[model samples]
Target chain A: MTETTIAAPERSRRANLLRTQEGVLFVVLVAIIIGLSLLSDRFLTVNNLLNQTRLFTETALLALPMTLIIISGGIDLSVGSMLAWSAVMLGFSWQLVGLPLPLAVLICLLTGLLGGVINGLLIAYVRVPPLIATLATLAIYRGFSFGISQARSARGFPEEFAFWGQGQVGPFPTQFVILVVLIVIAHLVLSRTGFGRWVYAIGNNEVAARYSGIPVERVKFTLYAASGLMAGLAAFIFTSRVTTTRADAATGLELDVIAAVVLGGTSIFGGSGSIIGTVLGLLIITLLRNGLLLTGVKGDATFMVIGLVLILAVLINNLVRRR
Target chain B: MATQAGRLTQAHRQRGLFAQQEAVIAAAILVMTFVVSLANPDFFSATNLLDIAVNTAYIAVAAAGMTMVIVSGNIDISVGSMLGVCATIAGELARNGTPIPIAFLAAVAAGGLIGAINGALVAYARIPAIVVTLGMLSILRGGLILVTQGRWIESLPEEFFFSQRSTLGVPNPIWVMIAVTILVGLFMKYHRFGRAIYAVGGNAEAARLAGIDPRRVYMFVFVMNGLLVGLAAVLYASRFTAIQSNAGQGFELAVISGAVVGGVSILGGTGTVIGALLGSLLISLIGTASIFLKVSPFWLQAVQGGLILLTVLVDVVRRRRRA
Candidate 1:
């Protein structure tokens, strides 16, 4: 209930360092890295590590906003679908409809914005619950993705288009670099601004926050649109990397992003979580996946581990709180 | 005395609201029936009706359980994965020469076991139901693929396709859906445990103070959900000659949306199986209506999503008017 938890000052921050989820997860993440390094030589390599980061850049993009969304006591289950829809539209417009690639990308981002705004309008203005509103969009967008593309993938984009997806920026994947930059921005926005405080306030108690003169509807509306915009950018990165845009792109991705955020110790009920925690959570998941693949585990099998980790993370959080 | 009478009337009107939801859904079903019959005159043929019923059967059954979970103030995003797991179990067992009935029962039992895990975590570990189920969703989905390696079960005894046959001129699948809906619907209405679920969802602390064990209620709803999922799995799995490991992917969305569209509030505490079943029927009709109308089947998902949003919008508007 203290302001310190939301925007920790240096002194109080240090005091709660050991008790915070970020601290525990940092220790756990280090232990995992070391343990995986021991288990597989390939696991500790810079190439593999960056490769892992590159793999999740798109979803990590989503986790960034998801932290805010959950902290605001709302959820957007349509992000994966948003990614697919945007990706599909990006491809469809450019390849099928003969639009310029740059314009196509703009359309993609616009589609994402439009979808998010609709979700926000439904939830904030119409008072539809977040879960139900997003669920509807999840289907509608994915369907449009498939239908617009006529169920076929769009491929063979201009050569320059691949740079954002497959290009490297001094040993860092381009997408990861973009992700890191966004992470910092999201971090500042979430922890160091009145807007961020409003998100936490809304999460803790929407009615109370509203009575206290916060613009609850505007904040929620903006967050959802932000989510959609992020999903749109992710869609671009994902399609560029894979060099293909299919309706099924990023299928089940919402699960992975959610798993990472929740595993980072964000309360699903909202109001408490940090960008650092989400980043570490994302790192742990990506590392475990890469390590498992190195250790002869199939990529998909890591989903089982992630699922267990997601649950165990919350379990540990509950235990810590009780203590 | 005046306030007492007013309070009684208010309660009566509240009950009437739920009845209104059911009536609205039934009306939708009637309207859809007319549309289908008008568009495809042969749609009412016994054969065509049975085919449609078969499709609606599993969805309605699953949504009925989903209705219970939502009414109890929780959700199970793992429904699709659980259904996949259960169906795979049934298929794998039958392929291993197990009795058809035993395989079906084992699938159902496995569902209950998984549900119990979800319940236990949500109840005892103090994990949010969404997180617990999301974890289960990942675990089951990943584990199923890991175990099956995306293989399909092709060979099966004739008796394994129990749902494909007609009984007393009605396909067995219709019978299964109807029986499950009837039983679940009645239990939810008249049973003490059912009413307790409503109390717990409406307010857990109030229910606990009023002598209801909310934990037990949570467990019961989840477990019951699992059992219904089992039945749904067996029925769904029986329809295909080749049981793909990925069966039921994205199915939870359909089922949950069906329940919500049928009138179950995502925030919980109210909805009925009859409404849910009718909602499922309505969805099935829309899907078929597209094909019958010569619209691309791809538009079905968008229609479903749009319908959910439309229904929720109506619900929200009506509730606002009442307030």
Candidate 2:
């Protein structure tokens, strides 16, 4: 039997930075940045760097929770749909129902939370596999969004809403600032909290975790619910950036989110990953997307490059892990 | 009975469970058809029935392959994109004056090659199936757009219409679907390689000790799946006037959902193509029923999601009762 039958084991107690996965990712990220900068003069500029961060803020937010979900040995394929649903609700509540923008935002967040709760209930309480549960929700949420919006786009949000995505705070994009705060909080929670340990425990072995009284179901439920809430928050930011709420917004976003998390060295089988690693992965992906665009690579070609990166990254990681 | 059912999975008695599940889906389909036809007698029209079967035939064919892949304990989210690529290749070749059968063969061959790459990476390189396919999804999707420049391939040759033609008084698409299903279904039930797929999925190490190479099984299933996707692509493509850039969008969900709903466990090593075809038929029925029931078509996804949830819940309950 290969190790795939079980969760990845604990990290080695002996630390070696250069030998670590994150260290390798950091090196790769630097190399790509240098390569891209040489390819395009615009790539090295501070303005471009700051601007690029805005486009990736939503991915970063979703990646944080996605990392947690994947680390816990579960997946949520519906995050993109949840984001779309929340965005639809935001616009529907604001424009269609004539609610205050702030209230609409709150409702958006609630919709996300509710969506997560549904997943949590199915997975945690009902013991439905996360993949199937989320897949179903993916369709359900997307359908609901389309049904309510009639596949129409909602545009023209108030300036305050726009500020969350595009407005600057002293030189940093507002979304970038928000990402930093959440990133640090996520890091602390993942690295320092008892709940965090429980997450790893459950992923490492759910049966043992249950016997150890780790409240396995609760942890899973909370993780999924939190994933939904974060998706809502990301939807809010995404809507603010685009200044439009459409049911189709964030279509296929789960790929970027999951790609970054996996590239960060998160194990698909569960346990053994880092937020620091995720941030690095996020930076690498964002850089490639922006860098490729700056180098005159059309939007579609960038997908190919990212796809190659995704496959090669894991391929390399697995070969090294085997050694 | 409870004890026997309890040991169903461990003992690998897939037929009993699959038959039970198939019956459930068949009953649901009957109820759904009855309800819809009662609401609108036109739903029972021969033309509409034929139309439904024609449309569902492609999904069913693809799902037959999906059931095998899932049974082998892996997934390919890239199937939809692969189909798009196959269809593009077929159309491009046909437009270039290649013989229609040869063009279709080339498309299927291209699909097989892509599947081989995916399989090699998963089996040899040890990348997670989901991650690899996720990457492939991006590559193919982006690559297709880059090649086609967001344009649909139209004015296909008259002889290229695969779905419209018939043999022995049955529509060609339906014949293809049924033939593929029967061949694969028989292969799965009686072939040594097919049994190897289950053995590998159930316990790779044990299968290895028993002289079965898990790697070969992995490769075979992926390539086989790709071929089916290619066949499905051409079938679906020929029915429409143009092969759109967004061809096969959201298709993976329908195929995978059908497999799971048909009682093929995502956990691997258990399930049947017959059940998967039934599951796909059930889903397509819901989609068709929506049109006749006069509800928003978008609600189709919600129903699909709900049905998946309900099916999974039932499986869980059944497992619990046996315990």
List each candidate's DockQ score: 0.83, 0.74
lDDT (C-alpha, whole model) for all candidates: 0.87, 0.88
Task: Give a tens-digit lDDT track for model 2, residues A1-323.
Answer: 46534423323341242248888999999999899999999899999999989999998999998898999999999999999999999999999999999999999999999999999999999998899889889888998989899888888887778899889999999999999999999989987898988988888898999999999999999999999999999989999999999988888888889999998988888977889889999999899988988878788778888899988988887877788
DockQ of 1: 0.83
Q: Which ten residues in a row have the lowest lDDT in candidate 2 chain B?
A: B1-10
lDDT of 1 by residue, B166-205 (tens): 8998889889888988998899888888878877887788
Report the lDDT tens digits of candidate 1 across residue range A118-175.
8888888888889889999999998888788878999988788888889989988898
**True A-B contacts kept by model 1:** 0.87
Model 1, runs deviating above 4 Å: A1-19, B1-19
User: In model 2, what lDDT does residue B94 have?
Assistant: 93
TM-score of every prediction relative to native: 0.95, 0.95
lDDT of 2 by residue, B223-276 (tens): 999989999998988888789987988899889998999988898877889999
